[model samples]
Target: MADILFQHEPLIRLGAFAGAFAAMALWELASPRRRQAIGRSVRWPGNLGVVVLDSLLVRLLFPTAAVGVALLAERHDWGLFAALSAPTWLAVVASVILLDLAIYLQHVMFHAVPALWRLHRMHHADLEFDTTTGVRFHPVEILLSMLLKLAAVAALGAPPVAVLVFEVVLNASSLFNHGNVRIPAGLDRALRWLVVTPDMHRVHHSVVPRETNSNFGFNLPWWDRLFGTYRAQPEAGHDAMTIGIEQFRDPRELRLDRMLLQPWRSDAGRYPIGRREPGG
Candidate 1:
């Protein structure tokens, strides 16, 4: 199973991404939670473009990717799982959970660190929030995130299957939780306990600085509650709350070239967690 997965990792990931994206796009069209001021024509092109660029860069720079690193670690008896002589099932489950936690921490770090926020803020700069917003990360941030995930996979001695599962699930979950589609309030409340719901994750994109800092988890909802970064809803309410950062309010910033240039265009602004004024 592992060998087969390793050989076909790209196909598996692409298939999952396409299926999830299509599903969410349809769902959004059918039951959108909020009216979009800016249509997909204005945002999807740049957002999708970023996905293409990020994919090509990752494949070109780290051809083997995380699953390959995991296989190498297992062969060399490297990292925690190898040292503990853990059972395969336990390693897989624990590795998936730990990897999610690592990603959660990385998200928070991106907001808290000034320099890192410059790269990550591009994702938050989308004037509208939707499924495409989920995958709209700057290339530099994507590369840095891949490096972090690679290090975590090797250090944990994660199984190749587990790494593959985590990667696919993370991609799918990002699309799901970032969708503009609505869920019934009762259902959304219950779903938040198990997975990050769209409503829960939307608060992270709120224009308000503090709201933007909360609910950083992309795959799991627990880390936010565990760390007290969870915000139930935007202060203005989801329908009324504004999306995107203050710096790039112009629609032109939604273009691919402007997005690529955002990190160099200005000061980190008031959004970086470290830059927030005391009691403001």
Candidate 2:
């Protein structure tokens, strides 16, 4: 199974990514939930450009990435599960869940730590929220996330197949939850019980600091609920609430070049974990 997965890993991930991206793009256009502040022409090029840059950066820095690391660990009988002689199926399920929890905690860390938030806020700084917004993470954050995932895989002795499944599903879920497609309210509520639906994640992208800190889960919705960070809806209706952060509202700053320099150019302390009281 591992050999087959390794042989087809690239194709599998590429297909899932392309398929999810296209579907979300089309759906967002067909039934967008919010009126876009910045048009697709302005937003997509920069967002997708960052994705390209992130891909190149990750490939250059870590040729193997998380799945590759998992394969190696499996071969050497490394990590916790391997040492404990856990069942293959059990290890796979446990790894995927634990990895998801790790990501949820990592996201909270990014928001709480000012320096890390500088990189993460780029994702929140987009003037509009949509599918492309999901892939707009700064390259630095991408590299850091990869290192974290690789470490988790090594520590847990995650099955290679589980790591592959997590990567592909996480990518797809990020796209799904970040999309602008208008899902039915009833359906959105139902979906959030199991996964982070578009509505659930849109709250996290809200300009309001409190909303921005909530709903940090990218794939699973349970973590936020369990951790008491879950928010049902944006205080302002999804269509009414502003997206992006309080600062960097200038359209000129939305360009790819400006976005790359954002962390250094902007103050890291503007947005933090708690709500900012008015009348400052």
Candidate 3:
């Protein structure tokens, strides 16, 4: 079992990249704001490399933990392994939905918890919110998040099939939600009912603190709706809202070295000293 998983790791990783890349390419073609993103030379490699490294690191560090957890707590038992023979598509969809739900909780915690915010802020450090921006998380944040997700997978009893499917859905959605794409107004409104539409997600990455806090769900729109955290698109919405945390305004702050060392910098006197209240 472990051997099969290890052998397929590259293929699985590539599959995720393919999905994300397709969405990003399509979104770039459709969205007038493509230029707003950091641009391909920086965008493509940076986003791709970071996601791969982070995911691979997570997998290597926790070898089979996800699979083990899934096996032990799985509610349904088809056999000793519970190797259910459902269609792959079903497994994929189930996995995506479950993983996304877990992510929503983690995202909320990052904003609400002060210590987590210190690490998660690096994600918000981007001066822009584009497809590539979605993958620009701090390594520490990624590690911490993977640990939380390991627990979630165990609790949810997610199968390998589900994990595979979730990886694809996650990659694709992150690209779509973060891509500077503008879906047709009518289509976008309707789609947000089932999935996280770009319009809805754009609000989450808004420079305005109020806008930043809404729409944290990564895949479906259900959690945001159910939790009373949902925000509708602004009637007279600006196509471009400011992006990034105010504290990371300096040009040098974009550097990886600076980003890694950011928390240690005693800029406690900084205007946005810490995360201000959502609307602050």
Task: Find the candidate with the highest lDDT and give its number.
Answer: 1
Taking all chains together, the TM-score of candidate 3 against the true structure is: 0.79
What's the true lDDT of residue 225 in model 2?
97
Comparing 2 and 3 by lDDT, which wins?
2
As for candidate 2, its clashing pairs are: none
Tens-place lDDT per residue, model 3, 1-280, is 5346545855776777777777677757766553464545644554456666776787688775455455554545432223655454565566667678889988988876666777777767677667777777777888888788777766555666566556566767877777777678899889998889777887776666656677888888999999988888633364646677667777566666676666555442222324566455
Model 2 ranges off by over 4 Å: 274-280
Candidate lDDT values, in order: 0.95, 0.91, 0.68
**Model 3 accuracy (lDDT, Cα):** 0.68
Candidate topping TM-score? 1
The alpha-carbon root-mean-square deviation between model 1 and the true structure, to one decimal in Å, is 0.9
Ranking by lDDT: 1, 2, 3
| Candidate 1 lDDT by residue in tens digits, 1-280 | 7778999999999999999999999999999999999999999999999999999999999999999999999889999999999999999999999999999999999999989999999999999999999999999999999999999999999999999999999999999999999999999999999999999999999989999999999988999999999999999999999999989999999999999999998988888885655587
The 10-residue segment with the lowest total lDDT in model 3: 266-275
